[model samples]
Target: MNRVPVSSSNLSSVGYDESNQVLEIEFHGGRVYQYFDVPQRIHQELMNAGSHGKYFHRNIEDKYRYDQVK
Candidate 1:
């Protein structure tokens, strides 16, 4: 997955795989996680949001199944 860097205190970048509904998020402390069963719209909204970290916590975090990548 190709992640795009974002400006966020808690988040670093994001990547999405639409075919498999996987959303990958990289955090500032080098922790990376992949969320499963994510909708493309949620990924789009997250990328477009002004506060990526806030959006992730409020919308994506704990909402989908995920695994730590790094």
Candidate 2:
């Protein structure tokens, strides 16, 4: 997936696959993760959020199945 860089304390970038409902997040430390069964609205909200990390924690984390990509 192609990811776009974002301004965040812990996150470096984010990407989404609408067809597959997968959300990929890359952290500053170089760790990347893909969250499954995600909604497009959530991905859009994350991109528009003031704090990506906060929004992820509040709405996404522990809410979907995920896998580490890097």
Compute each candidate's TM-score over C-alphas.
0.97, 0.97
Q: On residues 1-68, what C-alpha lDDT tens digit does candidate 2 reach at each position?
A: 99999999989999999999999999999999999999999999999999999999999999999999
Regions of candidate 1 where Cα sits further than 4 Å from its true position = none
Off by over 4 Å in 2: none
Q: Model 2 residue 61 lDDT?
A: 92
1-70 per-residue lDDT for model 1 (tens digits): 9999999999999999999999999999899999999999999999999899999999999999999989
Q: Pick the candidate with the highest lDDT.
A: 2
Which residue pairs in model 1 clash with each other? none
